[model samples]
Target: MLEMAKIVVQKTGEQIPVMYNPTELSLNKTVVLLGQGSNIQFQRVEDDDLTVSLFFDTYEQQIDVRTKTDKIAALTQPTVGTADRREPPVVVFTWAGPLFTGMISKLDQKFTMFLRSGIPVRAELSVTFKRVLTPEEDQHDQGKFNCRQLWLVRENDRLYMIAQKTLGSPDQWRLIAQTNGIYNVLDFPTREDVGRTLVIIDTHGETFNEVGNV
Candidate 1:
């Protein structure tokens, strides 16, 4: 069976299921451009937007279709009392898996069917979701964690021994030596060096060899 699509409110964790699956979905992105013609260049990749059309039908149950559409529409309003939330709520539009994670940026409702009293029985909704990444993801995408850290030297710790303990290979010790200015391996980390520390680079590559290279 085809699974129904749903919108999940990230703040309140409310799952608002769509009555009918959208016939089509669109994902669009715009790039940041600079200069013109011969001097033109791309500055960066800009944000993306996900657009979907949803349909609702409550004619058989004789209820207002707004009861369903209202939930999605309310996502456009800023949360009251939440001083930090000046914009609409962030939500996940999902089916099979997450299709998009964003905030509802635009919404247009069209009444297609109504009862004798003008109560909407069926409606179509056009929704636009603006893309945004969480702070952790944004930082990761920006390579903020490709940094070095400190490793304290313990008693009786040699370079190869430290390498084995910290980097999982005894032979990969030259990386540690070269990165920390430990050219005099024989004269380093003796009993007098028991309480020293070294800067451990959080990277490894084809450039790093297994031995004597330090």
Candidate 2:
């Protein structure tokens, strides 16, 4: 059986349980790609974003729509009255040992059913979360690099720009293309390459050489 997923708010240390676990969860990730006439270039991928739809109701339940909405709002809101002035609460959704950590980027609620007095009795919340990586996590990921690094295409990213950024020179762009098996030397990269992961070879501090020469 799948374990229930719970959202944990770091600021208030509150754990909000979903009344009915989301039947479907959507995760979105994309790479940056640019379009040129008749050609495509691969770029870098963006961070993962998560979206989940939650249902809340008072049908034979003690918590009403108003109360449940209020609790969720608190988890999504920024903390107040602190001298440090921190960002909005960091939320973690954990289920079956896998976890996603992020801040609530969007919260949309709809009241579906109402009581005779017009009070809301049932609601649905569609929440979107943008992923956040801590410095330690980023460092750990970097440490895992070996002879090759994986790069995700981002918007406005080009092979030369990525080469310069990663290997310290735009002149080494061909190395990237060669490593990724991109043989189209006649045209520039296009939007089709966006969201693609490209393998980047580490030159080991050596100068670029033709694949035939090596």
Candidate 3:
């Protein structure tokens, strides 16, 4: 399993602090968040000034993958049907419990992000796992596990449904965190931060629109 590390959010303006309970959030819990759509950016005002904060949380865990025979093989290679699709392995997890409902009101409209700042805006959550180093433990194991990162967008209809089908799992949130570089996932947003620009990619893996000055 993965463990949650610290969370950090980068944005424009001054520094903003994040608050959490160290007891429940100790080193072993998997940090997660829930959403409705691809609009991952949000903002809020504090001290009469506009501050934007990117929302990302972190978790630490080891992904479990099983092996077959005694002869070791490169399991990370792509298969025939899945050939030429050398994308990163992604997992997404959902916070489907009482804590999710409680956090709704806390994040609503109390957030905002500037779209004009042209800065590298990022919100990240992370997970840190203990490293096991032993030959015997490696040879005879139930499965394989490793550190994985993912990029996190909002849980919209398209991504939410697509992830379930593509990844074959709905709550494997580590994939989302890996894609979005979220090591620390619960780093909340502020009022002065600006969101990153959107890049519209086409079917042939080409850019359809100009970036920044579009």
- Best candidate per lDDT, number? 1
Model 3, range 39-58, lDDT digits (tens) per residue?
Answer: 54222111111112223222
Candidate 2 residue lDDT tens string, 19-99: 788887766657556687778654544567798888888956644687877777776666744777856778888776446
lDDT of 1 by residue, 1-214 (tens): 9899999998788999999998888776566678998998654454578889888999999999999999999999987335765778889999988989998989999999999999999999999998879876654544445655578888777888877766677766788888777777987787656787887665433234754352
List candidate 3 segments past 4 Å from native. Answer: 1-168, 188-214
Evaluated at residue 167, the lDDT of candidate 2 is: 87
How far in Å is the alpha carbon of 56 misplaced in model 1? 0.7
RMSD of each: 10.7, 12.0, 28.4
Candidate with best TM-score:
1
lDDT score for residue 67 of model 2: 85
Off by over 4 Å in 2: 11-13, 33-45, 80-84, 139-214
Compared with the true structure, all predictions reach lDDT values of 0.81, 0.74, 0.25
- Each candidate: how many clashes? 0, 15, 59
Model 2 weakest lDDT span, ten residues long: 138-147
Clashes of 2: 15
